[model samples]
Target chain A: MPPKSTKSNQSTGVTSPSGYLLTCDPPMKQFIINLNDKKSADKKFILEDLDATHLLIKGDVRDEITRKVDEWMDENVFSTIERVGENLDTS
Target chain B: MHQNWEQKISSYFSCSQVQNVLVMPAPSKRKRAGDASSTASKVGRSSADSSASSAANTATQAASELTKIDPQEELLSTSKSLFEYLERLPPGTLRSIYNLPPPGGATVAAAVLRSSSLTDIARQCALRLVACGGKFKVGSIVEKWIQRHGQRDALLALRRLESMGILEPLGLANRPGQGNDDIDDEANDSEKRAKLMAKIACLTPEFKGAMKLHLSTMSSSPWPTIAREQIEEFKKSGGGAKSDGGEKESRDPPAPYELELYTQSSWDSVLHFLVGSDEAGKDKGGVEEPPEVMIQFLTRIGLMQEDPDYNGADRSRAPLVITSKGYEFMLRDTNAQVWQFVLQYLNSLAHHNMKDAIRMEALSFLICLGSCRVGEGYFNSVLQSKSARILMKDLARFGLLFVCRVAGKKAFYPTRVAVNLVASNEKEGSRQTDAIGQSVAATRSLEESLSAPVPSRSHLAVVVQTNFQVVAYTTSKLHISTLALFCDVESYRRLPNVIFFHITRDSIRSAFRLGVKADQILRFLHVHAHPMLRNGDHQLVPSNVTDQILLWDRERRRVVMDEVWAHQCRDSSEFAAVGQYASDLDALAWGNAHTNKLYVHFGKSEMVYAYIRKWRTKHYNS
Candidate 1:
């Protein structure tokens, strides 16, 4: 089943709720999940994995997480030129 | 005084002016003769001869009596006498009588007359009349002239010139009333019959003055002389006539269809590059690649974007990918696409700090080209400004003109695409473009290799099955690549005439990631459906397949994220009150009465807070 948005808050009986909005594609969501798993409980940035393409995370770490994603995309996503080169070599 | 009278009397008798007086009896016997002699004295004062005056008076008396006898005869005799009087006038006097002053001052009248540019037919008609001394009977003579010149629409040309004040009607033949009735009755007759009604026309004084100035300026100008010299130099250096006859043979200008093919091939290369077809770079022999400036322009307009994953290692080598906007642009008909490109080019000119006059000239030149005949060639020297000539070259690069050189004479033909540039009717414009496309395709198939495909034939049909299988009946590499964007390529197969592929979940999700919407895909398929499927009663693409595609697209978009302030209330009643206030403010994001929780959108959070404070204070104070 697809992961749905988490409705139940973790802090019971709290008067106010706060979190940061994180939007990314499903693959990026998986990356965030792996990052959460690698970190200690206190250092985990994610408050909730809301759905396939969204996350509820600690507001202070939002910029750091976004920078990491950018770095990852730069390293992992192949440019069109490289892809064309690869196709040429394979053909 | 007696000698002068005798001289005048002898002259009038010798000229036969006193025939009536000679025939009349003595003045005492004829009262009319006495009246004629009295009238003659008044006419003789300018000539200074009494007997001559008496003879002239007798002629007038005879004319009046003849008028009393017969009106037609009176008109005939009066006209004959008038003609004789005119013939006797000296040449200098006649010249002075006909040379009327222009209505307005010469310069102002000339400017006003030349301000409105004439249509081709009207210009030809004006030039013909001016050559014929600017006055002609406007019936069979003008009609025959128009026919001899091979101008079919003589009536339209005449009316146009008449409206422009270049020609004025002197008088109509036949009686004035009868002419008016004929005009009214023959208003709907064929042009030939209507043109038979004789009328006299002359060039207006303003037009004549303007033409004189124009001719004088044209002859005195140094520009045409310089241009002639330049053409001679070009001929000598460019191997026009003095070249070895073997390789430098002069050829006739390209026909309209050939120009269309050239234009389509150039344009197709640009589109293929945008689509990132594998064949784009390989097909350089027949098609010219779009210039670097155009590629940069595409990026600037957000149609294609530089790949974000490039790490700025080599800027020039950076790969540009078609953005979602570019994909959408590809779906538009040729005319709309060309217009968008042209408008964007104009906008880029403004951004590049081009002079206002040059930009306006370019726009007007485009409008003029739009009205030009498709196959006709216009001299390149007609573009007077240096910047306008450069613009002509640029437009040629854009497939809007076919620049040709024959015997050192450079001329440009506006292609079918260029001629239809300013077409206002959307349906007709697309139809014309499609016809050109079909013709180009038909010709290319004859000369191109069997494996090669013509990308200009954009409307080639595609067939889709209920089981997600797709069959596209086209050999175009551009079309295949575009389909590969959203189709499972693992199962893709290509043949000489058709390509086969399958739509899969992973491929669609990847397409969604690229910002392509399911509706755009569905629209593309519907528009390019196979003719067989289009004519059938069933849906173009199976209904279940379309539904599944929509469902797949909807799955990833379920999450809605908004910034909000969450509030946990003490009781359901408190939650209800706060929720109602937030809802009234249209800032309520979500609320659960059972849990006594409510969320207000971030923008209106302070207002909700103020309301809550006011409510608590009121309840506690009361």
Candidate 2:
């Protein structure tokens, strides 16, 4: 699961930061395609680069491509955050 | 009404996840915003934009020179704005909003409003998403919401998205709602503002997680001044192996890697990460490459040669894949070694903007920096706030710090090599004298370490004083030749890592010409000189000698090349290719552009040699 935020604030015309959104990775594009396949059940959507891999979302069961892909792309392309963290409290 | 709306807005969007989602503006609109922001890099925007009624276009020339140099001033001011959004973003919705659809669809307005305005009616929308996670048409999602409720409700819903890290974060001293908004009089100190600005100066990028992932995947390094902590860990772990830097991770109990040679695949990953980024496909979705690759690489070709039970590899057992020793070494201080390589690699690629491929490396880099003991008094909360994961990863991937594993976590140990990556590392520079004194003391200790030796025994000062008619210290041949390069040699021989030489006018001139100005060289000598010269007259190296050296260097030209790897191609790019990928064993070579540095590390010695010698008859001298 993605790490949850603590406090929330008021509205401003803020937009998602592009640098954070499209971090520019080859696997990100493919990860989205693989994420959308509902029937594949491979749930394993992998983003690989260098000698490291950031995440592997299990999306093998879905066959329809777009939503699954969008969902995976939502988390993977924009971040490489893993489960382990500092100052993180998981109760 | 505006205040009430703002309050209602805050209340509606108080959920962190909703705040996170609202942070992202609609995708199409942001693309335009990105372009407007890019111009900020070129032009100097006034700092008054926060309260200003309209955007000012104040970029001119001539007397506006200082303004031009202060180019990123706008970026600086906006840093606060961005940070708040990320901080305020409601948890789950933050990432969702950032992932807005790429245009086109029914319910576009609803999806826009619902997702964007999540904070205001987040539960309602989340209920909608739970109601229609897969079936809702995005554009229609917005239209449907407005149709159900009225435009007032829709506008409020839309306003919800505004709370997420959407609008570029302005440089507010604190998160919008975190600080006291009523600081009207007493606390209005410029000093406090300066502290706030300093805290801001040290603030990590709002998208620190992405930045780390970006650097890690892209294989970039941190700036030179900020040494990757991983490297420091390596040094501590290597030399201080007897003692723990702090704590060691328990993931893999310390074990020795028993390998004879590195398999081509594992070796490449290690080298590539070190050289900059790990290879494509090999990183395995790791922050970069797994530590296993480092052990495998080192075991295969390094210090393991001394292992008594080493049987290279059982070509018959597993073929020459990876030896056990290789695995152990990598696990030993793998994070640090990787950091050292990345820092050097990033230093090499300093000229390029981060590419996506090496982000994992950068992430690993930052993890190593942040890995250091946390909540310790080493860096205050303010400095931590400023850099955190963002600068750390970027700096580490580029090999700014020597990173190592500590307390089951990655830790950073900085090195002095990368010069500009320093993020106020010393903590308090408020007292200039203290800062200078700290530096001087550090230098003194460093010089002493070099002189406190065994065997061949030669001090750099003795070597410099040779031409000044003094018997010098030092037995290292490498040092002798290096000294001879600029100082006149009274005596020396290039036998190996040892030698002896006297500093002379010609060499002094050369040294001065090569950037070791007379004063600096003299200072170096004074600091490291035989303890006897501490109180001696100013005739340390002799002003006459220094003058003559400066005179000699007058006509000499010192060339510096800023070299970097331009592109990577299969070494066999010369071969005709219909459609064949080079097998893992194929020898890979790189194309390089050495900008102004005069030396290149030799393939065989792994030592930097004058490029002129390596290039032979190449196109031209740098």
Candidate 3:
């Protein structure tokens, strides 16, 4: 017999925790989780890890989370303008 | 009332010194009036005999009073009587009389009227009327004119003369019960009045004097003289015979079917460029690129725009991308699309400060083309004005005409496209055969054969599956490119006769950004669905795919961010109480007892706060 399926064991609740629900890709969720771990005591932004793509976070820290995500994106992403500049430099 | 006007007209003529001019034609005019009285009796008549006797007496008296008078004085008296007769008529009657159709059913007369300018055809008709002694029965002149030059141009000339007040209708009496009439009766009354007005007409003496002045100043024969001379000069230079290498071939014009093919191909090339098909940019497909001016015009009208990424030294050489307007234009039937281009051309003429005379010539020439028999070659030399010649060439570029040069003599044949340019969209499909005298079934088959290379008609060309797979059964580069507008290129698979692509979320989103609506894409697919799909008892382009496409479009606009206040509670009981209270106020956005938190909508945060304070006081007091 196959091992018991974990699908039935997963929680299926109608009610959700009240917070600012943030939905994003799995990588972005991981990034947010890492950011929450780095925060000092009593300054935790996330209230619950809802799923791989969702996070229930403190409403007061929403602006701070957005700023951090935008900063990370600016550093990680290669924009069209920057790519064009790099190509010009190589040429 | 009928006898009163007749007697007054005779008396007026008898007293005037110009009676000689009227007396010479009195007997003939009396006979004509006698003939008309038979038809006039149908409306209402007490006694035809009495009216005949009265008219006969006036004619005899006018004959007795006949005397040679000065031409100038004669013209003045004639003008006075003409104006007097016109003034005596009711304004409504006068308007209906003007609205009457000319004798030979000139359908193009309405367009000529809108242009509000006289054309060469109208001028020729005026000259013919003047030459025929300045007075003739409306039917005879129109019949004679139609017999010689065809019916299409005759009424345009006649209508223009009437509008200019040079030609006046004489016998249209106001109907008896016109005042208390319903719409249907009024329409019938107008038709009857129009029939009566078609009886007889005469030139006003003021116009005759002007014509005399015009004639005295003219150096050559007023009509066709310049055209004849130009042709003669051209022939003398061996332009007609030697250029085509054979005299016989030079004289024979291309058939209407051939002209249609030529026009269709040229027009397809223009559409191809608008769709940004590879064929339009390359010569491999033998697609003739539309003229540079036309391309510029497309950009100016916002149907196309220079690609922002194409940064070339020559801006004119930059690649063009179609705009939303262009896609909308492509969705319309060919007839409507052509008319739009023609109207835009007319507007551009005004914008460029073209002279009014040249503009009128171009306008009348376009209207004339609408009335021309398809495949019939009109001599280019007939267009004496340089501007008209240039307009003809431009129209040729637009695929409205097929211009062929035989020996240096250019003769432009109006294609079916040009002939139906002014036809309304509803009538275009049915009336196509009327232009070329072909059967409807034959024309449809011929059209399909000619249009094989381009999916111009609403023929079955697309097969869409419930899996979001789209297969277009066309090899035309234009059709393929258009399909790519909202189809995933990464999934594009090409076959000899079919091209397969998928409708992906990203592709549809990009199309939405380009301003194409989800419904338009669905409608496009449905309109071009495969015949097999249509015959089956199933929706074209499965409902699921259409729904998903629409859902994707809505998804882009679905996620709306709004500010809200999160309320934290100490316990589950407190959370339940606050949540219930906020719910009663219809301001609770979210609530969870486990976390003991409640979220209030931002707009109602103050209301919730006051409630929470009141609740706290009551609980603490308890």
Candidate 4:
């Protein structure tokens, strides 16, 4: 079993700051997705359908998606700091 | 008159106009052309030749005297001295100077300055050169502009210039002679040209103000400036930077840490899929349909293999497994990992005959995404470009971006992977590596990450005990799956959060079969070993277990499994002929002359088979 994220880490409510993780399993929102291509017309996809591995998030998930990307950037910076520290130690 | 000429020369060759001077060939080359005109004068009738020769002799003496003047000192003291000397030459001599290789420096400088894609570091390096002193060593320029940028990055930038033919390393002249006159002459000419180029690069001031202005524009405003009114409208509509709680904050939005974390998982899942330990059923209840486009892309790159049993028509039923290529890819750092995958993707597209422009647009889009800020909606604006939109859709398949389409309106957000690529391109430099430059400031963190190798331990939550027992503190399925490669998971505990595993000889051999090296496994353990176990030195894991694991892995080397296709011929002569053909292709793996049989590597067997079939048909027909 994977270790459980703490209550704070477990994004529970959509409105909660910590709960706003894109990876968090949020409630399914009914949204109409119109494929930008010529082939597909307006169709329905749940928020879950826009999972990260095969993401197709459309409408209203803008804040959620932005929040997710921001988190990724922060992690990148954090890892960078860690790497720099390790290099310093080794040198 | 000499003093007045010197002042005119000095004023013209001021530091501010150094760019023009640098781009322009040295006064020495211009003097040589003047020498050419003097030769032309000497080529007339006897009396005329005699007078012309004497006149030319005096001119030669004057030119020689000018040459004796220390060029560096003259240029440094009075910028106009060199230009003044050039001015003294007849207009006919100017053509030869013009005929010389058009100043390579100014064009490169202009390109560097005007380039929207040039990284801040590269731009700064260019700016510094344009503002450099007339007399300076190559080492000094490198020290002043490049060293602090990062040693690897500096080398990459220099290499980039060398590849572009804008700068040539001084060492090329020192290489042993090719012994061919033409080659030697070319080398000599290039050496002279490079020296002149270096001088020009050192003193150029032509683009200094322009570069400074460009840098200031980059610093003051980025892409947002292009669509400034749109941004104002966005802010007016309360769609600007969001606060931590998804509210419109009075302050700028906090960095989107969660999105980055999501990006990490998204990328990790793709990696997990490659290694066969994806946390599918255990976490997500059931394995969702594998991302088909992503799988197809990986298959095309030969990183993942589709099930042999599945036909091309059945998309969902095609089971995919990680190839040996994928196994090696898992061990690389994220930048290298992403690079190899993207490179392979591009190569595969090229192989399939995709137009160069489309491939280039795909590449530029990736770099642009990397340069853009994490939370910005700039990705959507870039999608307005058709080729970029197509590329973004493919990028979403790679988990580099998440596309949102609502009622035919599409917006895309670049993931951390996409952003990392921007840093990768700039840090790596050179077209061979792929060049992608963004505004300098936006890429500072990305640059640091790209230039420095990230420690794998930072993500590890494992501990290897002296007794060969392994305990991991995290729930990341990826970690557990990786551990399962060389350790037997003895138990999974809940309360304090730990998974216990025992390293065994069999498990070690199993990992070796999967193309995992002894050192790789040891490094993994060493990186994951608990803080308490790390103790003074770098040897975190116990020496006994590490050595035993390596020995176990090595033991598998005794018998090699070579996959080959055996072919038998009717006669020894035929067998020998076919075998020779196979050997020529380097496909012949083994042969038994006694049995008139030969074996070829599976990968090359088809070609050998075709040749054999053709020879057999021709012989029988004849």
Candidate 5:
């Protein structure tokens, strides 16, 4: 949902540089994480609109951790990043 | 006279040195027993006590005569000859006059452009002073910024000022601590204490670092009394002392930390002693762990900054800098912050200063730390390469970095405390919706990001939710708890998760406590409503309802602050150092967040003595 990275703006856009990234997924969701930011989306439904709040992570490494948080993942990523719905009982 | 004193012709090293110390990260010359500023102050006071008239005449006549026969041709480097310009002016307009750009223009770049090394920056500043007709005591523009900026950067700025011959030393006249046995043989205890305090108040950057090492090393024991005594002495003597004596005495006694006296525990004390360099708290020296990185993060983010009340900007386009406030909050999430600074520092180290084998090995170990992923697989990588293999073997041997050659990368896991530190901080950083939303109200923007402010708390939790799922991408359990406490935690999942819960009043209320964007909870719920509701046009959550719930969440949120040392010693070397006293080291990291004062624990027993003796014979003299 966010704009892709541009070559000119080193700080902006999607990036996959050489380094370690964390990826965890099972039968439910898939999330790939890099030190800079993340990407995620739901599998079952496609949305017409999702604000910047739902799309990108816009802070430095530390800022992202303390504030400015967002990560894109598979819509069905069963973990917390994908959970939603009415009657979603936590009993 | 000519036979007794040989004139050593000091030549500018087209960037060369005698023993070629690693030019990149070479350290500095500390405060000594008899520096020139101390001598000058002594002369001023003695003259005041005798006849001010005689003293003034003697100095005037001498100064007048020296102008005729000035030997040193030192060219002052600073763009401003403000001190000389204001020699006859009143004090009221002195500040404004000096701060103004010269009619000529700012020549800071031309004054400092040549030498590549920080050493040269220091020396060039010195040479500039010589260039300025041998009077290096020009009013410095760099002073306030150095004292009031991020520690590392402040030191760099300070070092430059010192080079240009402009810094004034704090009255750090050496004296014994309260319990040192040599009290009676020296000056009056109370008088010496006053001197020590005054000295500490105006301490040069290096001695100030010595003071920190002393405090940390003396953490245990009846420290409140000792610290209070020293701090009170400084205050009474008109010293602008930093935060002092609010900490509880460590249950275990403190190890004594003295630069020269307590020859024991010198090894451990030296690392921290370096904290005195203007770079102390802001992370310039080699740090012990990943949390050191968090300090760097706090600086990078808008948390660290000079209070707008303090620094006014100049029209210079150089590296963006963090202010004093940025450095303060940096110590708030102390452990994580320490790591953040250390990581960037290690990265910086990689670019330069890899000359010594030991340093090169240390550099590689740090790079390995940066290069590795956060999860179990990468953490458990095979120990390959002789340097890394040796390092990894030692890490596992000491329980720092674990390995699983068979799984290749899937065998190890940083403990809850370990993984949550700065090494994994950036990973969990993206997941910090709570921190982001909360810090928004508190954080300074852009340049201010490097300077910390009064560490904020009321707004730090904005998006964390129950069931161990953080709103942001972070995997920090502490953040998870920030969210989980109010709501029903569904299950413990290793990774981040998103919940599709019903938009109930209670759920919305709980979400509000996490932070402001929190107003979006109702909307968050609406978008993920039941299948039947999803088909309808009410995709946006109701505004008033969202606002109410967010307000409720704010009402419910509470912050629990951690002391500076609530972190583990995860480095192989430090762990090995700890292995000799594992239980004590672990206690230092966990027990009192402020009590990460390892030297104190070691001081009480054989630990401090042993380490000090070993270090003095090795590090101190070296």
Candidate 6:
């Protein structure tokens, strides 16, 4: 089972859309993740699997998680633009 | 080449700094914030938008740098953080969390985290995979969290993770009874996945059951519920062919026996080259020897001393002799042998004060390759920089990596030697010998037709006789050269696969002069003893030979050698003062009170002379 949303609330008050918590108060150190998927959940769906991953970060999870999400999004945009540029050159 | 005694003595104590060397910048200065993101971008962002709050920038900067260097450094620091996290919890919660076994996923998990160039994605992927028990379908991960937006990046991320040992390709053998564990020869990918669907999973090296246990017990938010029925389905139908549950899981395919022979010969030639032995001139059968760059590296590290009479104008005629250090190095285990050179190279960089970040990048890259699957292709990624490419090329020359270049593209593969170099071999006592034994076992199982002529196993071919005679059962040029270190080869026989040699007092003494200790000789003999003579539990060589070798060693060490000068004083009182001064300077070799004479060693004689000359002047002036 994914870490209980209740457990995350009790530990770090930072809340996300699907009960994911990223707190930076105690410094996110290490978290154990379960890579196996739930059978009842839509195995073919997208974004739902993010809730399947448990995150343990150092300090307050709020700040670190926000920064991480923002950085990841930026990477996606940057790579997409670079791919476009490569396509233009190839064509 | 005699020198003046005064000048020689002074020179021995002098300290001089060589000024012509390049110094590298500090690591922190090179760790620029947003460098990872910025490197990928062509159009620059405005300064106002680029300049984030200093704290946030530094945190990201630190994270980026940590990923570049040792990926395990983050795991180590985070584990420490977890320990602290556990300490702050209430007693009841703490007790429950503590009761759960520690997650045994550090090394493999750390490698997965290092797989991605972007820190955030790597972290998320690693966390989820570990929670799911280190096994996930590649398709599941790609479709669920990483599609549509950054699909290419996500795919590349998975490939990188697979190459770095995080996700293993579950071939026919990984399942319960499909593959015969007795055979180690690698099957082609097509042959492995011919009828079955491609299955990939995160696995800890040498430990899968423990990882599963830890994941099952983990109950926390964000850990998805694992379907027991689905897992049972995978476990039952995963393997292609079902048989009697007797086949052992083969972790990795062993390289062909010829590769082992090639690696050994190349390394041994370098050592043989130092001992000034004719074994270096032996047959190569067309395979190339290790490059001259390795010889130069040994010379640079003070392991091999260059010939003083050699001329640089005749570059091809350069000759080098093994120094005392090199002789000692010969007896070290193979891992240690490689490390001695790598450590020396790293130290040379440090000696020049090369930038810590650059040094760390090179060091961590090499270490990371240890876990990478052999024969896998890694396209341009983190190792795209010119320096990184050059370093990889240099390592390839040493036979640590086999670089395959095809039509302007290069894919590097780690050889058995490279994998062995970085294997965290934890078992102590005779493990190197066991490594040799395992190599032989692999060779035996690989080819039976070519077994008689080539000595199937490198480790199983040596036999030690009670009469101080050694017989090595192999045709490997490397084995022959290593045996020549302290033995006289009597004959090379083909039928029974044996090369005979006799150990003598003179040979052992000569080797000792070159700094090969008695213990090292014994260890070599023990580790390389024939599989027949080396009964798993007993001593390898005869006790008489070991005892005689030690006795010969003890005989030589009984005498002391030193350079000293005897000085006569005007009186016993003056002699006492002079002797006291010599003793204080640590130069007094011997003192005779009756004769008013004192002896001083050559190195500290200058200090002794200055002190006595001043004393005499003071006595006369008074």
- Judging by DockQ against the true structure, name the best candidate: 1
- TM-score of predicted chain B, candidate 2: 0.28
Instruction: Report the error of model 6 at residue B446, Å.
Output: 12
lDDT of each: 0.55, 0.31, 0.55, 0.45, 0.28, 0.46
Docking class for model 1 is incorrect
Error of 1 at B355 (Å): 3.6
The estimated TM-scores of all candidates read 0.44, 0.26, 0.42, 0.43, 0.20, 0.42
DockQ for each numbered candidate: 0.08, 0.01, 0.03, 0.01, 0.01, 0.00
Give the lowest summed-lDDT range of ten residues in model 3 chain B. Answer: B40-49
The collision pairs in model 1 are B40-B57
In model 3, where do residues sit more than 4 Å from their true spots? A1-91, B1-108, B111-257, B281-283, B310-333, B351-354, B372-386, B405-410, B425-460, B463-469, B504-506, B519-622
TM-score (2 decimals) of chain A in model 6: 0.25
Best by TM-score: 1
Model 2 regions more than 4 Å off: A1-91, B1-344, B347-410, B416-467, B470-472, B490-500, B506-541, B555-622
- Model 5 RMSD in Å is 32.5
Candidate 4 chain B, poorest ten consecutive residues by summed lDDT: B15-24
Which stretches in model 1 have alpha-carbon errors above 4 Å? Answer: A1-91, B1-260, B283-288, B302-340, B351-354, B367-386, B405-460, B465-467, B526-548, B566-622
| Model 3 TM | 0.42
Candidate 5 lDDT, B392-451, residue by residue in tens = 432331223333321111233222222223233333324432221122212222113212
1 or 6, which is superior by lDDT?
A: 1
Candidate 6 residue lDDT tens string, B1-622: 1223222211111111111011111121123222532321211111111224442243234323433434323222232112121222222332222122233132222332433222455456655776777777655665576666464455445543443334454332221123333222322244533322245556544224333444465442111222345335545664423323554331122245544544554455456555555544334342222233344356555676655666667433345656788777777655556655554344333312233433444444554455554433343333644545555655554556654432122345555666555442322222445455445533443334235555542333556767776767665555566676777543323335556667776677677876788888887776566555534666677788889889878755332334455456878867988888888778876666777766666666667766766776677557
Interface RMSD, all candidates in order, equals 13.6, 29.0, 17.5, 27.9, 21.5, 37.9
When candidate 4 is compared with the true two-chain complex, its DockQ is 0.01
Tens-place lDDT per residue, model 4, B1-622, is 4334333222211211111221112123234334544433222111111223443344223323433444432332221112222223222232222222212122223433334333465555555564553234554455565667644454344433332222333332221112334333433475753553354233223334333344445332123412346545656866533445654234222244434444445466467666666454243332222232334345545677655666667443356677767766665445556655565444333322232444444444553455565655442453444445445555554556655431122455565666656444433434222111122322333233223453221134456666776767645566677777777643333322456677766566677778878876765555445544434554567788777787666544322223456566777877988999999999876666888867676677778877876776676556
Local accuracy of candidate 2 as per-residue lDDT tens digits, B493-519: 332223444455455545554445544
